[model samples]
Target: SAVISQKPSRDICQRGTSLTIQCQVDSQVTMMFWYRQQPGQSLTLIATANQGSEATYESGFVIDKFPISRPNLTFSTLTVSNMSPEDSSIYLCSVLFSGGGFFGPGTRLTVL
Candidate 1:
């Protein structure tokens, strides 16, 4: 099992600003995934970060808007670019563990 930590439990920011969230893992992992969950909405995969290679982003997400960095096997970062009120959601870092999944506490973002 791997333990994950995310920065900024919650934050409120103005529109047109950006926030970079950091994710740390206790142990090395093969694949790290990012997700977004809006209020009353299901969780959606944002991207998959593989060590030693570029991150694979899901549809509707672009490198310019959601840049990802995975420098090693146990850490990653995601930057939310050009924030807007509609971007308000719970951003999470997830990892597969023991054939299941685990998530961070989540960074609740509210762009005003």
Candidate 2:
């Protein structure tokens, strides 16, 4: 089982600014993902982080808006670039291992 944690649990940023959320896993995992949960909405798959390669972004997401980096199996980072109020949401890091899917505490961003 892999234990996951995220940095900057919550943040308030001005519109047009960006914030990077860090996700760390205790063990190496092959499948890792980034999700966004908007207010009163279900989770949306942002992208899948591929180690040593470019991340696979979902239909509505793009590399320029939400860049992801999976430097290694244990760590990844997602940056919300050129953020706006619409970008304000709960960003969660998830990993699938032998045990099951584990999610990080999540980084809540509020764009003002």
Candidate 3:
């Protein structure tokens, strides 16, 4: 299992602004994923980031809006760009390890 941590647990930003969320894992992982959870909704896979490669985003999400970077096995970042009020949600990073998935505490964002 890997211990995960996220920075700026929560933030309030104005519309059209952007925010970058950081994820740190305790151990090396082959693949890392980013997810978004809207209010009262389940977690939705945003993108899959692998070291040394471009991130693969899920349907309804694009690289221009949600960019991801996996610099190494243990570190990754997801940025929400040109955020709007509808973008307010909790963003999380996760990794599959030893047949199980571990996720960070989550970065809560509220776009005004």
Task: Go through the candidates in order and give the clash count of each.
Answer: 0, 0, 0
Q: Is candidate 1 or candidate 3 better by lDDT?
A: 3
A best-first ranking of the candidates according to their TM-score comes to 3, 2, 1
Name the candidate, 2 or 3, with the larger lDDT value: 3
* Candidate 2 structure quality by residue, lDDT tens digits, 4-110: 99999999999998899999999887768999999889999999997888999999999999999999989999999999999989999999876778899999999
Task: For residue 96, give model 3's deviation from the true position in Å.
Answer: 0.5
Question: TM per model?
Answer: 0.96, 0.96, 0.97
Q: What tens-digit string does per-residue lDDT give for candidate 3 at 14-76?
A: 999999999999998889999999999999999999999999989999999999989998999
Winning model by TM-score: 3
Which number leads on lDDT? 3
Clashing pairs in 1: none
Global lDDT of each model? 0.93, 0.93, 0.95
Candidate 1: misplaced stretches above 4 Å?
none
Q: Per-residue lDDT tens digits of candidate 1, residues 1-112?
A: 6679999888999999999988999999989999999988999999999999989989998889999999989899999999999999999999998778999989999999
Ten-residue segment with the worst summed lDDT in candidate 2? 95-104
The alpha-carbon lDDT assigned to residue 42 of candidate 3 equals: 100
